[model samples]
Target chain A: MLFSYRIMAIPSKKLAKEDGYTRLKDDFKGYLAGTVFFKNTIIHGYPHIKRIFTLEEGIKRNIKEDGFSVEEKIDGYNVRVAMVGGEVFAFTRAGKIEPYASEKLSFLKEFFKENPGIVVCGEMVGNTPFTPPTDGFDFRFYVFDFMKEKTILPFDEKQKLIKEYNLLQVPFLGKFRKSEEPWKKLREIASFLNKGKSEGMVIKALSGKEAVKYVTPNADIEDIRQNARFVFDMPVGFFNQRVFRSALFLEEFGMDVEEYKKRLGDAFYSSLLEGIKQLKKEGVVREEFRVFVEKEETWNAIYSVLKKSKEIEISDVYKWKEGNRIGVRFSKIYRKTTEKLRRFLSGYAIQD
Target chain B: MLFSYRIMAIPSKKLAKEDGYTRLKDDFKGYLAGTVFFKNTIIHGYPHIKRIFTLEEGIKRNIKEDGFSVEEKIDGYNVRVAMVGGEVFAFTRAGKIEPYASEKLSFLKEFFKENPGIVVCGEMVGNTPFTPPTDGFDFRFYVFDFMKEKTILPFDEKQKLIKEYNLLQVPFLGKFRKSEEPWKKLREIASFLNKGKSEGMVIKALSGKEAVKYVTPNADIEDIRQNARFVFDMPVGFFNQRVFRSALFLEEFGMDVEEYKKRLGDAFYSSLLEGIKQLKKEGVVREEFRVFVEKEETWNAIYSVLKKSKEIEISDVYKWKEGNRIGVRFSKIYRKTTEKLRRFLSGYAIQD
Candidate 1:
């Protein structure tokens, strides 16, 4: 039975504005109006789990609380396996399939060729020498669920099927008799397995009901610790590309440019760019382009000015940064030349 | 003291992709790269909230269990009043001030003249009745917080100053002695208050800490319920603008559009547009023009085709429905044609 609540009715005037049905429709329209489809939604999904504690925390909590479970935290790629009809397809955390696994796709295709109705979910984990350390990157299969026709198999049954398929299943952490025990075990696991690049553990419910099926804790801390060394060690251009990609991604997701500025803020953006430039200049990040501050600021200032201007113009200051950080320089000579040129061409200048 | 946690320090590769910080040359550059700025942040912010909620179910829980405190839901336009050196400047929710208020700027000039240190936060609740409410509006000066010398006033002191100023505060709903009591009271209050033209309540913490704040349950429910009615009532064009505004707001908050689609789909949008069109035609909404949906399938199809296209254009068959539920053939064709023509000339032409 669907659980429902009876909501108080709203007045006609106020109701018109807050109508969810209409709001939903507008949302779909907005998406359709944009370029990318199913962009971040399919990858990130809604209600994304923000944090997952490290393995140390899990083990600690388990040890402290007798009721906790201590499962082996596997090192592998997070692959969300889904079944569409009789086919089983594995998607990376971001929903893309690995290009190197094209042969595996055929294997999957052949497997589905016989199993026309069943779908099995599992993680694909394997050992490779050149792979990013098992701490961050290890290929392992963690079978989570399965589906058939319109029915999703129970958690236990899904686990059973993983063994039947000979797929690598994530070691099942024993069930905690008490809820509080898990927290302690989580802490222990975080502390124990934290050494030597082992990222952490993800505590998950055997019966996955909620969208946030798993929790990761010390993983983020580890991530921060590992990356802090490079904080001052990346090239300005390289770093700039990363920043630009994020902005473009935001824009691709249909975010307004103004919103980008508000969220990042002037000071923080300034610092981040400066950090990258410093890293590059210090030979930490190898690059040849001279990292200059004045030129960068001028471009930003111009962009800021043009952002709200009625007319859009390609200012001479606009220069391409590594990827898309359009940098423009403003100087006395350039300023005079621009004014003189503007005055000279005022009659012929076209209004945007 | 700052709360610190040990985490695996893996910095996001996307950090370097931010546009604003990519070109800077200092150590601080790109720090704020992907962060949402006030203006740009909103676009990402709303979507981020959506994403967070989808994962954690926090917002849904908050909406259901944390029955919102019913304050006098302000009827006046949303205004953000800021005091700079004791000079109070009022800005619309979008940050623009009312034109008439510009003439009254001198009234607060003396406050700045007298004490250039105190800054007050207030809202012009019932000042301009440009959009007259069917019911009488009550203007209250509800003060939430304050900022002075770049630092916010202490929470307790801020409340005291608000009281001292004799500014009308959004009334506090009683603090529940028991956790369960608040939810019960919420139902009762919702039933009692939702009958009339009252929009709904704005719940706040009685301790004056902005710990958790939300709109009343009644309002949320009303919004959803009315959405169905609005679809059948309002015009499509007017509805589209409202949707666009909401989208713009979300984009300004740096929200991903996909989240919007997942939460609110095409069917809901079309229904709302149709409802608005109907409302306008029936003289319910006084607006002259109405928002119309070109076709039901057009919205859905756009996603399929334009998922990768940077720019897209599409057109579909549309029909207008009046409040009486009578279908009007091409009632808005001329208006639609003009809008499409204008957009086309502006290089936004995609398809029809």
Candidate 2:
């Protein structure tokens, strides 16, 4: 819970302009500032879910004695989807209206139209700009939580509604008692997911309403490799934690350390080679993001949101029409990373 | 050079106590704060050597067009050895008198007496408490530079003095011009050193007097593996730069990527497993340092110096007699890492 995203208050015009809260003036839905469109209607940001490094220890420490369920923790950006004033809106984990997610969720309009007063806490998975598609698929939303106002609905009711609306939901792993040794099954599931290039599971203590996430080695290793080029751009702990987590996963699950090490090393080599090639050939270090949006306006809206981050510059934007959609490609120029690699490649003596 | 350690000023008693400049009160040689023994007897800290990631561009950018010499870059901690008032003092790179280095250098008494006013800038290599010996030897000093006051003597003079004193000097790799293609030879040298478990070469511009260090892949990789358990205590860049350097080394030297990946992977696996084992068995993360000092006071002096760092806790002291020398073993308990592992192991939900 230390790093949980805090939803912002409805700010004044000046506050919104100053980025105290975000108000995307270019988008009609974001005119009100931040995720707070109306004081009466707000999608509360999801609570931070703690992680478990060791299955047995984590289960003993985090789970309740009984009445606990485990659900598939999808590897995607968290999006809170709901209808506001008859328009469906998808808010990012930070409670800001994400243009890409919001634009793509037009099909969910019917689900909200029928189920009023409820919001769907879902993951925008696949090749979305927000997250690297560890799920390895096209873009789609997978509902993980159904909430009314601030509280999540119980499992049965949420599932019944998902069935009624024919909505995709995270795979329900199952309920278990502490005495049943669920970690055995969970380890198998994590290993299976690791092979499928998917993520891990989240154990929810139903009675206590506390959730904890456990990940597979591939998920952590993939994270490191995916962002290797952005090494200079991100916080230093990003790589360390991933390495630590991979090690923990290997030890706890009784996985073959040699195979995993090769996988990890190969992942590092291939990804880092890309970074080196960029420095050697292009004289820059960055990642290219390709997206297909339903509307040109949608891509523009996403660009506007990204550009406001100030420190990151969106560059090399090119768009091509693919029938009804606009296929666009862009790069988020990590200023610190690009400049750093350029400077180092320039043969400036570095103290190491 | 941006991260170069600044030699501290002679401070007031309060300032000294506040760590403005370290005054190791236990050692007679360290009574003066910082590396400054007296106004006229100070051994200046060596200037930071810049690093080159790419050999070709680095040679073009960092080397002089006319005159430059290449020498073996020793994989050890830098020490400035000088004698003042009949006592030989070995100041570390930051200019603090290293008790262990100073104590071990009694053999250098004659050399200092012979070459008074001229200090030796050398690397304290081998199985010392400082650097993990990539050179793979017992503790020994290899003189790389001879200096009077703050000025490093020219290559010829420094070598002559080293020869006269029968002192070990870093192997000279020969001088070359910009047009003769020195990078080709440097690459071969680096590859050879990589195989021997040594390090790369430092190309010093004789005319410009600027030095840039280029390292072999093994040196960078060894650094990462050696300090894997201390990951939490050190800066995040410690791993990042090493990873970056290894990849660059592969590309620049045209080494086998697949073999390096496996080695790198194995390195991460084995070293990190040690860290995990410590956390699991002892519920803490720490590194053990075993040292053999000729005098018991040397160990006391070293312990006193390390204990003053405040954040680090020296624990589990075990000492025994090895002939005339005292074989002392101690551990530096990394507080942040220990507490973090304990908390994570306790199964408290972590949002990360």
Candidate 3:
């Protein structure tokens, strides 16, 4: 993903304090742009940037003159897992705490018990529907870079942490000299993952001065297909992010926002219409469903919840005695078709 | 669905007899396009057309001034099931015999056992992966109109046949008077099928003078979503037809061919690239996957097929005794990556 660098200036801590907590922004620099909080722990922004250029372009521009280490670029979401104040947290690229990552939180907390305040930067791959195809692998975090606050830990220190903590890391292709042939090195890097079909390589200078990505043509094509297709199937929040990311990707390919809209905007609009139509169709049948409340202490609560809900209308309630307790059976229906329509629309709507 | 009227002009019987089978052409005039044969019996072309205008437009234009009967439009593929020489056969809208409609074949054959020349024209709905959501219904034949060779049976006669044969017919909405309010009639028609969310109506004149369709906004929206999505998911031949249909749909919406290409061509290209990349990835492991052929009488034929195939490579062959019979074992691999690539590419390729 690429964006105009000027548009993504790092927000200062003073601003974060002023705002109480920093909210995520659409920043394509991949640089840690801000700080936010979940409970008492600070969720730092991920600040890794990759240059977007073909290997040929990089070579022509003399950007790869410095010797670089190549790492296999895993097709997965950027996640920062850290243990702060003895509690574990996982944040997606958007800097929001991910509840789904709770399964791995205890394992991360174990690492934090030994070494607190270390940030594990990794690509969260597999299991999740959102992640790219993982080639029949289990979902696991692959730590690539470790950091203490804003400073990146040295590769050796990171490796040692991974080894001691039993953390999975991104597959390292190899160390490459500037004199190495670009195509041959690329081929070697590609063969390092998923049977010679790696996404590409992330080239990081040994001195940590610069890091850039060289995506294989195959990977880029796969990205385009995966990004364009099944977007309608994404939950609204993820869909919006994907659409925003698609804009950035198109921009990187020199396609303008207007062009993007012209090409795919109708599909998005059509999806919305489809959602609305589905709601209208489903609302008719779902509204008049019967609910039986068994005799229990929580029956009153259930009744109150149904009675108070503006969306649900109880047309009839019948009292019944069962097992020495009283219960009620209610014929409830949706108060308005618009209520179901809203729920349906939410699944397809684009959000900021 | 729109095609040039002049180009679709009827071909002569001489041409039909000379060609062995004369194919149907797009005739928006709604007259029987042509007759074609399957073995000995003739299959009639479905000559149905709808003026692409709202009921109001039709009224204002004085096109649908006479009284008409409205029928619910089911979104499905047009299928013509018939008995040709005591054998059941189904023809697609293009009048080509369809082998996939085998389930309906036996039923049609039973019907043909009594009335051998009858052609049941219907929309094949449900069961298939590609059809619009069938709302949990099984695959069915919803007969809309019926014909015997080149002649169409009247509405009442068709109903009798459907009742006698226990066949399903497209749900009839109601008869509309020209003096009635077009909007009111449309509303009545809309409320006629699927609990007020009808795909719209197909209005036929009682005098048999004119017939036209009025597709609801909901149906159009459903169509757009269905057309844009799951295109790559369709089988190659159907996928190509869908792409072509999508182009025609866009043109109906006043979008030119170039714009259609500009909007959707990339998705097709991306699908191709995705397919190629997948083939490359899968081919890596699949090329050397082992296969076992147990002792069989057709071993020589199997061996010949394997030997002749450009796709398979036999690394080793040895005589074996299995199940008290002699057999040959061959360690084989795929001969060419390009062969699989070509097959994969064909799946996602778009045809005009």
iRMS of each prediction in angstroms? 24.9, 1.7, 16.9
In the range A224-299, model 3's lDDT, one tens digit per residue, is 3443222323233333222322432333344343444444434433433333444445543122222222335335
CA RMSD per model (angstroms):
28.1, 5.9, 21.0
Chain A (alone) TM-scores for all candidate structures = 0.39, 0.85, 0.55
Considering only chain B, report the TM-score of each candidate against the true chain B: 0.41, 0.85, 0.56
Kindly provide the TM-score of model 3 when superposed on the true structure, using C-alpha atoms: 0.36
Candidate 2, residues B1-352, lDDT tens digits: the string is: 1211124333344122322233322212223223343334655546567788878788788766567788888877888878867988788765677888898887788987877887878888765666543334458787788767656787677767877878888888888877776667767777888897777888777742577888888987887788776677777588888887788778766789999888888887788888878988987787777778888788888888888776678899899997887887788788877777777666655766
TM-score of each prediction: 0.27, 0.87, 0.36
Query: How much of the real interface does each model capture, measured as fnat?
Result: 0.00, 0.74, 0.00
User: Which digits, one per residue and each the tens of the lDDT, describe model 3 over residues B117-149?
Assistant: 777787876633124334465467788877775
Clashes of 3: 2
lDDT of 1 by residue, B83-146 (tens): 4333344444333333323223335455445435444444444322222223253234455444
**Tens digits of lDDT, candidate 2, A89-154:** 788766677788888887889888778988888888765676553335558788888877657787
lDDT of 2: 0.73
Error of 3 at B352 (Å): 17
Ranking by TM-score: 2, 3, 1
